[model samples]
Target: MTDTSPASALDQDPPRRGWPKVDKVWLALLAALLALAVLDRAQLGPSLLFTAQALWDILPFLVASVLIAAWTKATGLDRHVSRVTAGNPARAIGLAALFGALSPFCSCGVVPIIAALLAAGVPLAPVMAFWLASPLMDPQMFLLMLSTFGWPLTLAKTGAAIGLGLLGGAVTQGLVRRDLLGEVLRPGVAPTCCAAKRSLKPEPVAWRFWQAPQRRATFRASGLETGHFLLKWLALAFLVESLMLAWLPAESIGAWLGADAWWAVPLAALAGIPAYLNGYAAVPTVAGLIELGMTPAAGLAFMLAGGVTSIPAAMAVFALVRRRVFALYVGLGLGGALLASLGYLLWAGGGSAG
Candidate 1:
C-alpha cells in the first residue's frame, strides 16, 4: 500500500518550473486590435482582398522555402555551413547569402536566430547576409509579389536581393576583422554525425526516422521547438499586417509613383531604408501604391529596398560587424534596387511602345 499524502508526493519528485510568462499587456493590445479589425466592416473587404493577393504573391517564395529547408536538412548543410563560415570569411559570405535567399524567417523573426548563429561561431559576413536576405528572399513575400505585382517585378526583386546579399557578404569578408567579434566568436564544433565517430551511433537515415514509440516523441519535440521559435514572431508580423491594412492610402501612392516619374524609383528606395518595415507589411503598401499609380518597377524597388535596408537591420549588422562592412551592405542594396528599377523602366517602355 502507498501513502497518498501531499508530503509523500512532494518527497517523490521536486516541483518543476512552468513555462515563461506571456506578455499580458501585449496580448491585450493584440486582442483589442483584433476586435477592432472584426468590428470595422468597411475595411474588412479591402483587407481580405489584400491578404488574398499577398497569399497568391507569396507562393513562389513558399515553394523555394520548402525546397531550401529540405535541402538543408537532407544534406546536413547547416553543419557544413557552420564549418565553412568558421574557416574562411569569403566562403562564409557566399554561404550566408545562399542560406539567406532560402531561409523563411523575416527580419524581425530572424534576430534571435542570427544571434544564436553568431554565438555558435558562424562567420560575420554570412550572418550579415542572412540578416539582409531573410526578409527579402522568403517564400511568402515572393508569392505576395507574384499575385500583387506580377512576375517581372518579382524576378527583379529576387535578382536585387541575391546581388545585394553577395555584395554585402563580400564587403563584410574583406573589411570586418575576426577579432572584432570578440567573445561572440568561438572555435567551430564538428558536425553531430562527425562528432559521434564511434559505430555505436545509429545510421543517419535510420536516426532521421524513429521506431513507432520514439516517433511520437520526436514529432512532439519538433513541434514544440518550432512553435516556440515562430509563434511570437508570427504574432508581430500579423500586427504589422493589420496596421498597414488600416492606414496606407492607395490613391496617394499611385499618384506619387507613376511610371513617367523617373525619380520615383530612387526616391522610393531611399525612403524605404529608415522605415524598418518588412516585406509582409510593405506588400500591402506597395499594392496601395500600385492602385495609386505607381509603376510595377517602382513598387518592386520599394518592396526589395524596404525589406533589406531598414535601420534596424543596418544597425544590427553594424553592431556585429565593422562600419565598412555595414556601409557596403547598405550601398549594395540601395544600388541594386536602383538598377533594377531603371531596368524595369526601360523594359516597360519598350514593351509599351512596341
Candidate 2:
C-alpha cells in the first residue's frame, strides 16, 4: 500500500466534474442556494425541510419535462410545425396559443419547445404567442386554478392567456412586417435542446424518426441537456419560493395588493416577477391571498405576471434569447397581466362572482 504507483492512484481518483463547474448557470444556482441556506439556518425556519419538500414536489414535473424533451427530439415535430405554420401569422399564433392551452407544460417546461421553434426558424410572433400563453393556464394548471379559485377566475385567466397570445402575435407581426424585429435570440444563448443543425436550411432526411440513429442520439442529448438546464433553475426557483413563503407570507401579499388601491394591480404584476412560483404551486398561496382579502383582480394579475416572468422561467428565456426579445417578453407579460386584472375587476364589479 505504501508503494504509491502513480497510474493506480490516478485510476482510483474520482472522475472530475468539469463542464458543470464551468457553467455560469450552475455556479449562479450554487451561489443562490448557499446564500439561502445561510439565511434559512440563521432564521431557524423550516428551511431545510422547505427546500427538500420543494424539490420533492417538483419531481413529477421533472419526469414529465424529461419525457417532453425526449419526445420533442424524437418527432422532429417543430420542423413539421414550422413548415405548416410559419408563413401564416394569425393562424400560426392562434394555433400556438391553442397548443399551449392544451399542453400540460409550465413556462420552464416549454423552454425546449421554445428552443426547437426558434432553432427551426419559426416566426417570432407565433412563438411569442405560444410563449405568452403557455405559462398562464395549461390544461393541468387550469384544473388546479379551478379547484383553488373558482370558475370565474379560471375562465378569466384562460381568456387572458388567449388574448395575450393574440396581442403578442399581432405586435410581433407588425415588427416582422416592418423589418423592425431584432434578433430573436443571441446566437450562442439558443438553448441546446438538440444537436445544432449546421445549416438553417431544412433538409429532408429519411422518414420515420425511430429508424434514424442520429435522431435517437439527438433525443438522448436533448433530454439530458434539457434536464440539466431545468433542474438547476427549478432548484433556485423553489429555494426562493421557500424563503418568500416563509418570510413574506401570503397574508402580506393581500395587504400589499389590496383591491382599494389604484396602484395595486400594477404592483401585483411587478411583485409577481420576482416572487411567483409556478402556476400550479401558486395555488395555495393565491388561495391564502384571496382569503386574506386580496382582490380577484389583483390575484389574476399576480398569477399572469408570475407565470410569464418567474425567476426560473425568465432566466431560461434570458439565457436562450437576446435582450430586446427578453424586454418584449417582460413587457408583454406585464401588460397582459394588467389587462387581465382590469378586465376581471370590471367584470367582478358587475357582480360576476363572490
Candidate 3:
C-alpha cells in the first residue's frame, strides 16, 4: 500500500521554504553597522576599527574558552552533572549550584538537561538552582569577563552566580516543603523532543576521549559550532560597545548608575530585566557602561539580573513551567541582583551616598 497522502508526506519531510527567520544578534549587528553608515559616515570607519581591534584583543581568551568548552563536551564530563549533584537535599542543592556556575552549557544546551532532570523526578529546587546559575556564569563567560574587567570583578560575578543559585534553590525548596509551589510542571506537558527525553539517561564519561574516533569527531564538531557561535556574538557585542562608547555620554550613564546614586543598584537590577542582553553580548556592553562612569556595583547588578532573565533563559523556563514558577524565577533573579550589588557597593567604597 502506497501511503502518498499530502499530510503524511508533509509530516515525513517538512517544508523548508517560506519560513522567514533571522538571527537576532546578526541582524542587530548588521542594523547597527547600517545605521552608523547612514547617520555618521565618519564615525563608521572609526567604529569598525574599534570593533576589529576589540575583537583582536579578546581573540586569545575567546579561543581558549571555546576550546575548553569543546573539550568538556568531547570528554563527556558534562554527563556527570546529574550524578555529582545527587544525594542529600541540601548537598544536592549546594552541588547543583556550584555545577551550574561552573558548567559550560549554553542557554539552549542546558534546556534538555533541565527538562530531563525534572522528568526524572528530581526535585524542582535543585534543578532551579542549576537553571538559575547555568546561564549567569560559565567557563567561557568567565574568561571573557576576566579579559574585560580583570580577575576581581570576574570572581565577584562568579560568586554572585553561585549565591543566586543557592538562594533560588533554598527558597523554592521551602515553598515546595509547604506545598505552596503547587505543580512543578505545566499540566499535560511532556518532553518536547527525543533529545530532551534522552538526556535523562546520559552515557558514561570517557576521560581518554582521544582513544576513540567518535570522540575525536565530537571534538571537531563541537569546537567548530562553538567557535562560530562565540565569534558572531562577540563580534556583535563589540560593535554595539564601540557605538556606545562613541555616542552615549559618560554623564548620562553616571547620573543613573554611578556610586553617588543611592538607588543605583536596585535601578540597575530592574533595568537589567528589560534590557537583558544574552550572556555573551553583555560582557562588552557592561564594560562600556563601566568605562562611561557606571559604578562597579551597578554593572555587576545589571549583569546578574540580565543574565538570569535574558530572553533565552526566561523563555526556556517559561516553556517548561507554569506562570507562578516563571514569576518566582524572575523575582529571584531581580532580588539576588539587588542584594549582591548593595553588598559590593558597601565593600568596594566606590563613591559617597547621595
Model 3 gets an lDDT of 0.70
Estimate every model's Cα lDDT from 0 to 1. 0.55, 0.70, 0.70
Better of 1 and 2 by lDDT: 2
lDDT (Cα, tens digit) per residue for candidate 1, span 1-354:
011112233445565799977865358546745765778767655654654554445445433433333333232243344454567666667767777877776654465465445433366677767767777876777787778767776767776677667776666665556443333321221122232232133223333433444433433443343333333333444444544535653334445566647688787777666544566667777777676566667776776776776654554444433455456667877887777677777777512211
* Candidate 2 residue-wise lDDT at 286: 74
Q: Compared with the true structure, what per-residue lDDT tens digits does model 3 show for residues 256-331? A: 6755477878888876754646578778777777776778888888888877775545655675678888899889
Q: Model 1: runs farther than 4 Å from truth?
A: 1-84, 88-91, 177-255, 274-277, 311-329, 346-354
Residues 229-258, model 2: lDDT tens digits: 656666665566556666766456656775
Q: TM-scores for all candidates?
A: 0.53, 0.75, 0.58
Worst 10-residue lDDT window for candidate 2 reads 1-10
Give the runs in model 2 whose Cα sits over 4 Å from its true position: 1-21, 42-81, 139-151, 189-201, 208-227, 281-284, 350-352
- Model 1 clash tally? 11
Q: How much is 310 displaced in model 3, in angstroms?
A: 2.3
